[model samples]
Target: MELGVNIWSFIDRILCWRQPCACCGAPGRALLCPGCLADLPRLDNPCRRCAEPLPAGATPLCPRCLGPRPPAFARVHALFAYAPPVDRLITGLKYHGRWEAARLLGSLLGEALAGADPLPDILVPVPLHPRRLRRRGYNQALELARHAAARAGLPLEAGRCRRVRHGPPQAGQDAAARRRAVRDAFAVDGRVDGLHVGLVDDVVTTAATVNELARVLRRAGAREVSVWCAARAGRTSGT
Candidate 1:
């Protein structure tokens, strides 16, 4: 057991290349080069409600959000639209234990939130079930949130929320299925009354996971919940 733990610890230390731009293998640059960073599929002029990418100067709210029913979370802020290098970086940190990916991606998340008008009072990383946490040895969301919270000058509360359900993997699942899988799956354990809570996650696809989590946080007396994801993803056919 000790040997296995040590092996994973080592793996976690070098999940991906630190310098030389992991994506294009260009030397001298950091994990991501400036050219690649500029070309990344970022969300431009995103909707305030869902963070859906919109045309420049388009309406602040998307047509869907203009409807009567909105989401449980008040807003979503995302840096990139889940694609290509961003997806690879996230996958490396999430599955292969690449600590550097978290450093790079988390720093980018922090940079994006640096000048926000209203930042959340506290950062709460979406929890992973104990089973997954033990298997992975770290929560990617927490790792990313650590950097973001530091840059944003906010407190990170990793223990505020807990995931009790060990649902099947959510990748490629549509919104409705994900909704069904995560219903009542989360429990809030900390005091959040009147506090503007920021929920951090690695990726947002269909927004089902964050939405369910927001419901739980609100029930626990949070003033309002906002989601901050490193990337916004498009729903897949199904995994």
Candidate 2:
């Protein structure tokens, strides 16, 4: 049995090696080449609650998300603002069949989790409803969480929570409308008692979705919930 397991593991690694890196097109580079990895647009100064770009020395939460405190925790950390090259990368992942982008994004998320002042006990990817999952043929958050879990050395509970409803995309909705659309959309599948859960998502805009998911997790006995996202979209016409 041990020898068979070792052989399988070796075969898996070989298969992985044949895939091209998602960024920079380097061979045997996991998902991103070193050059592309170095070029990721990292946010140096961002709003605390939403990760929006802020002027140097500015307050954490932007004026918008602060008028009323968010339903989730008081802080959110995003790796980059949703713009330009980063935006293009995300679009490629979502629409252009670039699944390897998830690996690159996950590595960045793992770094962010490592540098966090407070770390979570477990990582949970925001789940897609069954219908949506079938329609899209993949869940980007799950792909990211798998890579991030390995890099962070944290347990990932992919089945601990689930999306119970099929709701419209939160984009193009006002804050209030977003809240209504996502409210009670998530359900906890197992015990999270006393655990600090980190919720992972591909992007954050109004944050209504994360807020609702956090509420359900907390109600299910999670001690605390923190949200992490790859990008934070600025308030645009749809937002």
Candidate 3:
């Protein structure tokens, strides 16, 4: 069962690459087969502020984001839910040395925003801690940002934001724990006054990392900061 699931998931992720449709086994050309693309879980009714999946017939803002303390970032745009093929693609890019997955994910994000207006002035890929960077040999976020920025014809500003503190992986942490773990982990090295910046990443779980980085950017004079991620884990109540 597990192996079948993994194989299917792998096929689903082919939507972002120029390969045969994993689902229909068609000629490889586009990112995904139409049938498979239609099967992917898309977040249509997302929170206006944070882009969390909204409940059926719920308001634009999630309860957690509607609480007194608003998020630092202006908005979030994610392509898919953090499940199945999407999750597999992210994991493959980050852990399995799959650079093609990064490029494909980034391209998908770019295409999603093709017709949108008021695009970001700069794209900043979330930074990795020096230790982690050495271990991974590359920051997955940076690779994605490069592709997204190039496709969108936007400036890609990397290395301006640095991760100063290395925290434990956020895989098992709850909302509060995730917040605490990332709190003070980032620092802005240059000015971004009045700039509309977009922060790119592979996945958003609790959104703790992007929030902390957005806070830093705001403090450094950024006028706006938005998040662009490939997937979001799930919705969270206002906490």
Candidate 1 lDDT tens digits, 8-106 = 657655654356887787864367788887888877677889887667888999776788867899999898888888888888999998878888788
TM-score of each: 0.86, 0.82, 0.86
**Superior by TM-score: candidate 1 or candidate 2:** 1
lDDT (10s digit) by residue, model 2, range 1-239: 99996897687566567566555567763655667667777776777776767778888767866776555654676877776567777777765656557767887788888877688999999899999888888888888787788778889999888899889976677778888888788999977899999998888877788888888888889888998888887656263
Task: Supply candidate 2's per-residue lDDT for 235.
Answer: 52
Candidate 2 regions exceeding 4 Å error are 1-33, 55-57, 237-239
- Winner on lDDT between 1 and 2 is 1
lDDT order, best first, reads 1, 3, 2
Question: Once superposed on the true structure, which residue ranges of model 1 sit more than 4 Å away at CA?
Answer: 1-18, 53-64, 237-239
Clashing pairs in 1: 15-98
Candidate 3: where are CA atoms >4 Å away?
1-18, 22-25, 235-239
Tens-digit lDDT string for candidate 3 (107-190):
877776554466888889999999999999999999888778867878898988999999988777788888998989999987
**Model 2 C-alpha RMSD to native:** 3.2
- lDDT at residue 42 of model 2 (Cα atoms): 72
